[model samples]
Target: MDTPLSVLFSSAEDEKYVLDCMAYFMILMAACTFVCLLFKDASYGRYSSSKYGFLVNAKLAWFVQELPAFLLPVCLLIWASSAKSSLLANQLLIAMYMCHYTQRSLIYPFLIRGGKPTPFLPFFLAVVFCTYNGYMQIRYLSHYADYPADWVTNPCFIAALSWFVAGSALWLLGWLINLHSDHILRNLRGPGESGYKIPRGGMFEYVSAANYFGEITEWAGFAVAGQSVHSAAFAIFTAVVLSSRAFSHHKWYLAKFEDYPKTRKALIPFLV
Candidate 1:
């Protein structure tokens, strides 16, 4: 009996080719997303509209859509033949990928307070991206990634693995910033109060989308640490989407409040 993986990739070379194609596809998707967002705001959260057809509960949608990214890697490692998973370099890369998804899938959604429902189309599209990306990143790391035994220690591989050691600090800092920014946003409303309020302190003082900045930084650092085309593509995709979202958020904040700060940028500090 042929398994799905076997059917999709007959040999290791085939798998590598497919993964390369997928990374390029992600880059293309990122470009298309940026172009599309320029014309219309994505229908979710403050931008949610009825004409999008159906809406899914925000928490449910978040968890369900994000779950695949968390689960698929585990599935690939356990059931699929992943040769490099035991290697130190691959293990570290997989660990970094898992850490982000674990927080995203398990911890983030349930913490929501009066969050807006997601449009069905957006929710569905998110699921597709998660499923697609999860497979691409993990499959390559676990199965196709080939690094030398001293990749992490050798000066020659510093371009790839040394960055993993160096970028780990940046990744950790971004993760902490992301966590703190989310905490600030969640606590913005009082116990009984409703609706959005201007987030203060943390990254909020400098930018409207502090959370967005943190996540983008997180992935940019992840790309450096990962030193793979797939990770780089993902980081690009994250910046394009989140930066656009942040700009929308900045526009909304400026339009809604007469007292909004004039010096604050959208996604970046001091400059957009």
Candidate 2:
């Protein structure tokens, strides 16, 4: 049997490279954390006075947290590919990274129909966590893992490719649903809105937090394609964190909107 990739790190150069990558990764993460804090402060105001105990807009908070987390993997893929000259893995990883960022960059800002930026505390926490995980991921990928030279030609590779394709399709579908829902709701409210209300139609018909659900699915599919513990962990973390947020939103919706959709589930469809 092939030895697990984790047991493959045997060289001093590999170890040193991993350490260097980790140190740089940490610095980058710190910068992202600082930026997030600044955005949080500027966008949401001070954390103490906010209703949700932070200054971020509720709808945008999930992306704010996810953005840095998304960056770490991309950075890792870039560094690993450059250092190791592994064209196939590097390209695949880059594609995965770009797929996520493309959606984030193109779709996220517009999704904020209207709300303050995320609160400083949650934003800060997300940055820190993402940075930490990013560092860990780069460090590990640099030394401890290996993939097939003909990874793209392999059957498993094809399956992973399919997973990626499916995931991407789902992500796009979710994005459109999220966008439409936000559009409808935004037009309905017509700016200067506050407080939670029942978001209807689109994916919201099936899940109360359709946008969050889309985001979670997108990351989860990315992880499935990459097939890395780091990626999987990030996906799982995204799911758990977003699920909690969805639940919070669900509860808030029910409390605030008397006629909220009783049929919709929180994070999942047809299940909790």
Candidate 3:
């Protein structure tokens, strides 16, 4: 009695196992992020603190975050250039994780701008989980799964490429919007300013958290590029988490500033 469920499960035990592992890893990552945020809040002692002053040093924080991201891409390129299918998959997975690490490592610190350093414990845990899970994803892709190199040349590949390109363009545009907005906000604050302020202009005009919007877009692009269930799951998780953050930020902006832009929505622009 082979039920459909049984058949589906039986056919790809390894893929299922990999997916399960990834799911668990995502859950762990989410937990780690939450814990880090909690620690950050406790250490910073609320968002109202004027002692450390508001506004972390953007340049310094950016440098810290960018270091790993820069290095990881180089590693990915080297790995990707090699012809082994398993290694290629592994490299792709590593590249995905590295992309994420680069973003989290580089972006969050500078974005804080003067809060207590996000609790090191949670941050450290996240790093560990990402590193480990990323390794596993790569290992499975390289060693366990076999995919065609011309996977990219198939019709599915063409479609996936289209999605990837479109998604990537949107993602980059979102990033630019966020980056420019951040620049504007930073300049507005001047030197030695502390505390979060309502971000104005750019996508901030439409959404309270443009930077987050961009971040989500970036990962969504990756998911599109991969065109796999695993990639889609990661992107979905990222979107949900980031969207929540965007909502929270939006509410905070509305509460904190009388002059906060009225036109902008929370996570979506003029929609949600």
Best by lDDT: 1
Angstrom error of the Cα, residue 163, model 2: value is 5.1
lDDT against true structure, model 2: 0.60
- The candidate scoring highest on TM-score is 1
Of models 1 and 3, which has the larger TM-score?
Answer: 1
For residue 245, what is the lDDT in candidate 2? 62
Off by over 4 Å in 2: 1-86, 102-107, 134-145, 155-188, 191-195
Clashing pairs in 1: none
Q: For each candidate in the order shown, give its overall lDDT on alpha carbons.
A: 0.88, 0.60, 0.55
Clashes of each: 0, 6, 8
Please say which candidate is ahead in lDDT: 1 or 3. Answer: 1
Candidate 2 pairs with clashing backbones: 55-118, 55-119, 56-117, 56-118, 56-119, 57-117
Q: What is the C-alpha lDDT profile of model 3 across 214-237, one tens digit per residue? A: 777766766665555555556666
User: Which order, best to worst by TM-score?
Assistant: 1, 2, 3
Model 3, global lDDT = 0.55
lDDT of 2 by residue, 143-253 (tens): 443556666567767875676567656655655655565575565564576654566777888887787787777667656655666566666666655565677667767
Q: Residue 236 in model 1: shift from native, Å? A: 0.9
Which ranking of candidates, highest lDDT first? 1, 2, 3
